[model samples]
Structures are given as C-alpha cells and as structure tokens.
Target: MNTKSLTLRWNKRHWVLLTSLLLVLCLVMPQWASAHAYVVKASPEENELLVTAPQRLTLEFNESLQTAFYNIKITDPDGNQADDGNVQIDPQRPHILETGLRSGLGDGTYTVSWKAVSADGHPISGAYVFHIGEPSGSPAGLKDLASGSGAAGGPLKWIVSFTDWIQYLGLSVMLGILAFLLLRIAPASLQREPMDVPGSYKLLWISYGAASFAALVSLPLNTLYESGVDLNQFSWALIGSALKLTSFGQIWMLQMLIALLIAVTLLSGYDLDRTIRVRIWSSYGTLLLVLGWLLTHAMTGHPAAAEQRVLAVTMNFVHLVAAAFWIGALTAMAVCLPLLTNRLPAKVRGEIYWVTLRRFMAWGMGAVAVLVATGIYGSLVILPAPVLTSLFTTAYGLVLIGKIALLVVMLVFAGYHTKRAKAATGERLSRSLKAELAAGAIILALAAILTHLSPGQPASAGPYQGTETTEDGSVITLQVSPNVTGENQFEVSIKRADGSVVKDLEQVTLSLTHLDMDMGIYEITIPKNETGIYKADDYISMPGNWSIKVHALTRSLDALDAEFSIKAAKP
Candidate 1:
C-alpha cells in the first residue's frame, strides 16, 4: 500500500510516445487561440453624433468571438440599459457582433458596454460613448481605467495568479522528484537492495495534491473570470459558458484530465532494483502524460498568442520542461538530504550527500542553461523596441525585474552550496537549500503575476513613429514625441519616393481619438513652424489604443490623407 504499489513496468516505448505528443502539440493549436479581442470597428463609431438613434448596435473585432456570455448593452445618458438582451455574432462574418437597440433612444450621450470571450477563452470587456443628438461637451468614457479590454481585476486577478503559482510549484516538484527517483537515485543504488526515500515520496504526494487542487479550481475560477461574475454571483451557466465558449476554459479542462491520469499512473509501480526505473514508466505512458501536461501550460500561455507561434511555443515548452526538472529536483533534494538522517553513518552519509548534490547539479546546470537562455529571449520578445523603457515603465516590467533579481539570488545560493558541498555539514546544506527554495517561491509568484498581465507595454519615453507608403510612392511619416500619456507634440511629414518633401500642402488637421473608450477627439491644426516642420501639442487622457486620422489638402487641388493607430503608454 505504501508508495501506492501497482508493480507494473515500462521502457524505451516512451521515446515514441514523447515524440508523438510533441508532434500533436506542435502541429495542432486551438484555431482561435490568439490574442484578446478588442473592438476594431463600431457602428456609429466612437464619439459620432447621430441626428437619430441607430436601429442596431454593432461591434467588430480583430479576432473571432464566441456567443456564450457575450453582451452588448447601450446605456443612455441616464445610465439605463437600452439594447435588447439578445446579442449574437454575424453568421457570415464571424468577427462581427450585433444587437437591436430599442426605438426612440433619447439624445445626450449613450455608452455601449460590451463583454466577450475570445476563442482562446480570455475575457475582454470595454465601453465606448456616442452621442444621439448634438455633440456632448465631451465623450463619456475613461472613467473606469480597468474597464479596458484585458485580464481580470480586483480579487479575481490575485486569486487566479495565486492559483497559477501553486499549480506551477506543485507540478515542478512532482516532476523533479520522479526524475530524481527513477533516473538518478535508483540507478546509482542498483547494486544495493531496492531502497525507498519516504521523505521524498511524501513530499511528492503533497505536491501532487496541491497541483490537483489547482487544476480542479482552475475551471471555476476561469468561468468566473471569463463570465465576469463575482463569487456571490456564481452559477452553473458561467461554468458552461466558459467550457463551451472560451479557449481558456477548454484548455484548462484538458489539463485537469491529464492531471488525473498522472495521479492514477503514479500510485502504481514496481520497485525492484532491476525494475525501479520501470516502476514510474508504465510503458512510456507516464512520460507522455507528463509532457502533455507541460504542453498545456505552453498552449494556454502568452506564447500561444504570439505572432511567432511555433518558435514561441517550442521555446516555452523547453523552458517549462527544464525549469520543472531544475527547480523540482532541487526541491526534492531539500526534503531528502541523506546526510541529515541516522540511517547511515556520518562519513558514509556525507559522501552520499556530496555525490547526490554533484549529480543533481550536473543535470540542473544543463537545465539552468536552457532556462537562462530562453528566459532572456522571451523577455526581449515580449518587451519590444525600447525594451529598457518598457521594463521600467510598466507593472509587467516591474514584476519581471523582481523575478530576475530573485533568480539571481537563487543562483548565488546554488553556486555557494555547490562550492561547499565537499566540506559541508548537514545543517549547512539544509539552510542553503531552504534559501534557494525561498527565492524560487518568490520567483514563481512574479511569474504567476506576469501571466495575468499583457507584455505589450507600449514604450513610454520615445518619439513613437510609423511610416506608410501611398500608391504613387509617396511616404507619410507620423511621429509622437514622448509617447507617454500626457502633454506631447505630434508631427506629420509628407515625402515622395525620391526623398523630396511635399511642401505644397494647403492645410493639415490631426483627429486624435482614444480607441479603448469614448473620448472627445483632439482636432488640432498643425500650423507649419517657421523652420518648416508640421507639429502640434496635445494630451493623451489615458493609456490605451488611439487613432490619428490625417486630413490634408494640396495647394494644387490634390488631396493627401492617411489614418493610423498608435498605442500610448502609462505615465
């Protein structure tokens, strides 16, 4: 009954199983597993004044959306819901969602509030205001900063993040312990009688239980998140909607199933000297299941939403596998310090401890090599141009910095532990392991927090610029000086392919509008400077997406106009 003895065995059949699972993960990703969907186009566009109320409210997104738990509500100036309860996606055009508006909607300003689950299962919600009659003094939005389409907020965000940390900690520990037992410790002791490390095994079960709880709770939590329902408002409908409508819900559901399979496989194993490794194998099924489990983490992670899917997901999987082995093995070693027990003589135990530490570290160092390399590459990919600016200016960057710092400290502790292993006492080794694990726990916390954040932190301290070419080879360059959300100047330059400036423009007006919510447009007329530059001063009310429409006229009766969007970062 101990170590859940099922007495079966396995072998190199695992290699084939592992390869097949890799192919499945690499070749097949969820069709709609992409970025969070936001409003790309809106009927009666943001801040548009209508002489008469529209018959229906429609919104379009860059990504396809699901119908379950999706809503489109129009709130009148008095803040009353104005749209009919039925919101549905257009059958022909999967990206568009529409709902009928009640007749005779009163004037003033009406806000369209929307909520939807992206195919990947992430919840996104936002609101925009459009006036029914005359232009209201200003667009009615930007009041709730968190309302911008993105991750969960309030207690839910923290709850989900904390759960993510537990899930990671549990899985990594279990994986590391299994690798240590079957691959390292068991082989080394093959000449001796089959031995058991109860301390390590017990730790394994504890991790298993923790991971299971996280997997079980993940569904309900994701339901609440994607459905935008509070705990008190919990319902079966929320869970159903999440499972059927969002990729996130389904992805986690699959992971939970795999976890249950692992539990069953782990409980049964043969433990003779010849069959020790085979005990955990189960005809290669266990290895396949473990890898499939890790693959799910990558599938639902930020990498799944990346533009470079294969590279990002592959890099992420390798990083996850390496980290699981490294951190997990270290955790297992911390629990099973052979020198600390009286089962063996002090001199003999010391030598065993040294050997175990050295062997584990040799593999751990290789894991660390991949971890550090991928970690750096991922950081660069997530935080694009002006990387340093994004790192210091946003919450995501701040957390990443802390995680890296903790990792550095953990590495220092590991290096010192290795250096002193030959002459170390039991108590010293225990202290060193505890320190490293402590830092590791903090690192996981940061990593968990990061999952709930968007890595596209628009760089704040630069002249944001974009260039577009016209059919006739004319180029238009738009620039924003100090792209942070505050007072700033914008510049527009028109040039031909031959590098000559188009100085004959009669008039140029910039229509700046906030895309996340309704804001009064910044219609600025850029009078040319005596020095021959077109620029004007303006202010961005908040951090989000914005649109800049260029309206210009040529002195010779020709017209040149272009529209583009830019992201403004938080100040």
Candidate 2:
C-alpha cells in the first residue's frame, strides 16, 4: 500500500482496538467493582413469604452507610406504613441497618422501599415485597406506596462532588504555599540578604485567601451534602445536625481550624528578620497545625473508614505530606521563582537561583520517593488482594491506574526540568512546572472521585427473587436473573404444597408487568423439567419496578406472584 493508505489503515486498526478494549471494560468492570454500597442481605428477605409479621426490619450491606441519611418505609397491603419510619445503624454492626416495624400485620403482602447514603457518599435504593400468612391472589402493586430510599438526587450529588474538587484544589494550593514559604523562600532569605520577591508574596496571599474561602464554604457545603438537605429549606437546624452528627462535619470543623492557623502562620512570616523567621520556623505550633491538617484530611477519607485504619491513615498522611512538598516546590518554581530571577542583580541571580534550585532538588527527590512509597502502600490498603487484576477490573483501580499514569508523566517533566535547571530560567522552566501542576491537580480530582467509589466486588449476576405457595397445593418460586435491564433470565420452580417436586404439569406460563410505569403484560411460556424446575430467558426493554406472575395448570390451577425492582447498568 502507498504511505497515505497505509497510515489510514493503521489509524482504522487503532480505533478498532481502542473500541474493543472499551467494550471489554464495560462488560468486565461491573463484575469487579461497582461504586455504590450494595445490599448483602435484608431482614424478612426479598420476596420472603413469612407466616407471621416480624417486629423489625434489618438490612446488611457490603459497605457502610451514612446513618444519618438513610431511611426505610414499609407499607402493608392496606397501604398503611408498617415501619415507625426511623432508620438506624446497629451500634455493634456498622453495616447492619435496622428499623422498628409497627405491630398488627394482617394476612396480605407488604412492600418495603429504602434509600441510604453509602459511606462513600452516594445514595442507593430499591424495593422488595414479603407477604404475611398467605400470598395475595392479586398483585398488591404497592410500588407507589413504597417510600423510596432517600438517595441524594442527581443535582445534589453533582454539587457535592464539584464542591469536593474545588475544596481539595484550594487546600493543595494553600499547602503548596506553606511549603514554598517555609522550605524555599524563608531559607533562601536566611542564606543571604532578604530579596524583594513581590510575586511570591502575592501568590502566598492568594493561596491563603482562596483556602480560607474554600474552608468556610466547605463547612456548609458538606453539611448539605451529608444531610442531603435542600437549598430552599436549609436552616440552622440542618447545620447543627451536620456538625453534631456526621463525620464530614467534624472534619470540616478541623479544616476551619487549620485555615485559621494558616492565616496566623502567614502573618507570622511577614517579619523578614532572620531571628523572627527562624523562631517562627522553629515554632512547634506551626508544624503541629500543618501535620494535624494532613492527619484530619486522612481521617476524613476512605482510610479512616477502612479495615486497616491505622495503616491506611498513616500511609495517607505520609503520602499527602510528601505530595504537598513536591507540588509546593513546583508551584513555587512556577509562581515565585520568577520573582527572584527577574528582580535580583544579574550576578546574585545566578548564584541564588542555582543554590535555591539545588536545595529544592535534594528535598524534591526525597519527597518524590516518599510520595511513591506511600502511594503504593495506600493503594494496597484500598484495593483487595490480587491488586494487578483489580487494577483492570475495578473502577477505583482504573482511576488509580489513570492517576499513576499521569504521575508518570509528571515525573518525566520533573526529571526533564531538573536536568535543564542550570540552563533554563524564568518563564521556560515555569511553563514546564505549570504543566506538572495541571497534571497534579487532575490526579487530585481523580483521587476525589475514587474516594466516592466503593473498592469492592461487583454486583452479583444472580436474580432478584421471591418464593410463594398457592393455598391449594402448589409451591412456586420466581427469580429475575442479572437483575438488570436487557436480556434477563426468569427461573421458576414448582413443588407440591407438601414440599415434593411437582410433576405432570400440563402447562406453565409467566407474565410480567411494570408496577409504576404502564407497561402492559408481557407473557412467556416457561419450559418445565421433570425435576419441577421451569425456566425462560427474555429481555426486559427497560428498568423500573416490575411484577412477574406465574400460572401453572395441572389437575388444578395454581398461581404465584412477585415484584422486582430492576436497575439499569451504568453506561
């Protein structure tokens, strides 16, 4: 082929390969890491047919829930709520959810709807049904009556995620300023006569102001985020509840304290006297506040909530401190270094610039080493064993991999800049450093999103199911497999009321209908086996609340029904 044709063909092949890889990821990742906390088991169980009403309902999950934000409502056949409407986490078991049920359940089916904010801060919810005494002959269709799990709505989630990004950016910038001031600017002034670096001071002030604003805004934003409170009705009560009740609120309080300390530290640094600068530098308060800020950030993240909390938090703290030092130096090089190069005498500029960069290089190397070490350790803590496999299979792992890739790019830039430090000065070096900052910020954003994702196994492919027995003489069990829209498998099993495998059934038919949305009945013939198992494979066009009914004809008529809340897979 000619050169142009060959190039075109290669491009087409690359596109195909990329497309295929993405398709594979779409199919495979959900099997490894789903972002939301998922139900592991529930009290009375989904579609459980109870002979008597229970005193309470409980749910167990694979991830922790925000106890203050979860809700459960149970509705009886008569449409009265059976639950007291108060949801609580078990004190002894953080993942086990419990709620009191109203007494006096009659002989009919009852439905439950629940919504809970996972510890990662995303809301998830669903509905299930269970009958007391007997299976209601007709569909109770209590879909509307079922109170939804109060998952944060879409707009609210977006707002929270955005605020988290902005807050992290502000904090990183502020920390960078602190590192630059303490390790670079102050030290440089001590080595020689103090120089006028207006740009560096201006950048410091900007970082301080931005960090303070972000910290203040974060307090209320986090309150709204955690409580899932709406803007129209936000009040002092909501703010008070967040501060007293949620972990995020407590962390926000600590952040506010850090912001105040940062202000003090900046003010203390204003005196350029070597003795005062050294004294302020030596002050334990400043060091403690900085470390405490890092510690609190760690405590408020996934690490604090992790199984190996001590290790996770320690690694997180080390990782953050090292990263801040590196990013701070780079930011200083970009925004503050120019001030020294541009304003200083020609002869002193060469000497001071070289000295400052050499010192920065030594410290930067140590920081990068620590950053890499702690990053690896932190990843191990967050991800399950067989980390290599999870890196490809899980969403958190994928994002982490993306971050590592970006970090590699940053390291390359840092290496290049370090080599050229003697030859390159002013805007050229600053441009390279700015590129590194951009990459670093993106990594932080990815980290924020990663915090909101569950680092666990994917949802099960098995069906959402229920079992019931006809009053006369037949037992029926129905299951909706893959529990998601598009090509679901329905499995039904028939047995005699006395608990024997059913045989010699003339015919078996299954019909499905949406509970809320008006989808007319869709029916299918389920082929039966001699062992009393009947199965049909079909595709559900959409996701929503669906009710499936099974009718069997033998010497007599038998019927069983169940409701399923099917979810759509993420695109």
Best by TM-score: 1
Q: What lDDT is reached at residue 249 by model 1?
A: 70
Point out where model 1 deviates above 4 Å.
Answer: 1-35, 91-94, 103-106, 136-146, 185-187, 190-195, 270-280, 283-287, 339-342, 421-428, 457-542, 545-571
* Candidate 2 wrongly placed segments (more than 4 Å): 1-38, 61-67, 92-95, 116-126, 134-153, 184-196, 271-279, 282-288, 347-355, 422-427, 457-571
| Number of the predicted model whose lDDT against the real structure is largest | 1
Instruction: Measure candidate 2: CA RMSD.
Output: 12.0
Per-residue alpha-carbon lDDT of model 2 for 237-356, expressed as tens digits?
877877776777777788887868766765665556546655456333554565676677677646655555565666678777777667766777777766656566775675566556
TM-score of model 1 (CA atoms): 0.72
Candidate lDDT scores, in order, read 0.69, 0.63
What TM-scores do the predictions have? 0.72, 0.70
Q: lDDT, candidate 1, residue 76? A: 79
Q: What lDDT score is found at residue 502 in candidate 1? A: 84
lDDT of 1 by residue, 1-571 (tens): 3111111111124434544554455335332222356566778776677899899888888666766667787877776778877789998887788999888777887767777766445666765567887644433443442344554445787888888889888878877777776665433442232225556657766887897898789888867876787679998877877777677777777888888787666665433544756664652455567778777777765666655678777877887888777788888678765423446665566666666676666566667666776676667666634668668766677888998898899889877876665344555377778788878877877887777776554435466898888777878889987776556688889887899888887678888887655445757677644333588765554466689888766778777778888877654
